[model samples]
Target: DIAHQNKREIYNLLMRASADAVIRIAADPKHLGARVGVTSVLHTWGSAMTHHPHVHMIVPGGGLSEDGTKWIACRKNFFLSVRVLSRLYRRLILDGLSRLHKAGKLRFFGDHAKLADLAVFDAFLQPLRKIDWVVYAKEPFAGPKAVLAYLSRYTHRVAISNSRLIRVDDRGVTFRVKDYRITGPGRHTTMTLKTDEFIRRFLIHVLPKGQHRIRHYGFFGNGNRTANIARIRELLGAETPVPGLAHDNTIEDADAPARVLALPCPCCGGRLIIVDTFAPAQHPRAPPASARAAA
Candidate 1:
């Protein structure tokens, strides 16, 4: 409910706190003690289309020294402490929320009517400080292909994908969802929700107009990214990339036919089958055999 009323403010708070915490912790002598940069993307929906807002950041394994003389790499196979990040993130966000309330930028409605009072709001944030905010860091990508695959799956994903939708009938809307609490074969499951409830949950993630979901900070910031990357390459004595040529994992053949990613089906968890292919703006001659049989 709070997120619904203050979507823009809440998202902005998330971005600011995440970037700030990473930069601050990395600069500490106990940590990396260098100036680092990160690219952050905001995702507002969980697998079930719930309003679970969080930022996904991609940080280089190392950073430039404070004096900008050389690059400083983190210890192999590890990064900064997640505990330090969680605590600092909590403080920064709570502080931002207080400022918003004091500035009258935040709105309270429904059962939260009492939050308009300063004392009530302060009490509301009290419990949050004690609880550990989740700050996870996954293992580094295996290679460029893995990095590209991760970005392709998540960066622009919506609240839900049509491929996950199984059926819509008198039973309401049915879709596949991952139950993270469970493990092994029983983890994947299907859920059915009333039509109105499904729509309501989906709508909860729509952002306010003009809000940017992706952001970059520090050395990779928009104003100076090119210059910084060039300088870093020079310092490392690496060969410069060819001008106007973007690096990618695919074979460098412009005439080769494009192929779709082999993603598995959500319903049966089976590998994708290529029945047919079509060009841009052109429709397939007919439905696939399986879809035709299903219909």
Candidate 2:
């Protein structure tokens, strides 16, 4: 799985696009010398958790100035423009794919045999050029707390949440379907599937082990994240972050992260210690179960 060059190449191209896009944006006088971090997480599923591959990126609002002199604060209400970002992202990725095709690095499958031909490939991409690629940019979180809570969900994740797999009946397996509209975005609505189909759909999201779907990039590149972050703060003329602020941006900054896990306790901004938890069978047992009882 990881041995496939196409997957690796595609992954690289996506990373490059994010980095390049940031560079393009930074080059603009508006952005100054933005030293923003980009963290991209690979997700190969759609609302039904089907094999609809895409990446999610987390990005800070501003970056270091070009000269690393001042922090280039982004507009309070926005990140890069979704329309423009999408166009740039799509062009970079499609161009990479086209290059691979021309270099004989990409392969056409059984029915895609025509794609093996350069002319056919060119024709195939013709429509893509006309289509506005799906680059969505949701409003940045309300506050820093929201950002941390959001990152926790994707910093690590699984293909399916337990609440979704309702049952494994003959008629089909039952799970939740999310009506992003009605549920007011990132909310789940229920749906079902045949047992086999359920497995198939779920399997599509299974990443090859060791191939990390979650990744960090740019100022958060790990090598000199501290320095880059410092440069960014300097550029924006901001105070050194006290703590819990997001300097880590991502590959898929378009959509918001899924909120499967709980957020830090709002009542107490400080750490909320978890004393213990009960097992499924023992959960909510008796009239009033206590933490000690579960232990």
TM-score of 2: 0.72
Candidate 1 local lDDT, residue 109:
90
Query: Which ranges of candidate 2 are over 4 A from the true structure?
Result: 1-6, 30-33, 181-188, 233-295
Instruction: Please report the candidate that would top TM-score against the real structure.
Output: 1
Top lDDT prediction, candidate number? 1
Q: Which tens-of-lDDT digit does each residue in 82-192 have in candidate 2?
A: 667777878887788888777887765666777788988888888988888777777888887797677666655566777567777668877777765665555766778
Model 2 lDDT at residue 171? 86
lDDT score at residue 80, model 2, on the 0-100 scale: 72
- Number of clashes recorded per candidate: 0, 28
Model 1: per-residue lDDT, tens digit, 73-155?
89988889999999999999999999999999999998998999999999999999899897999988897667766766666
Looking at candidate 2, the ten consecutive residues that score lowest on lDDT are 244-253
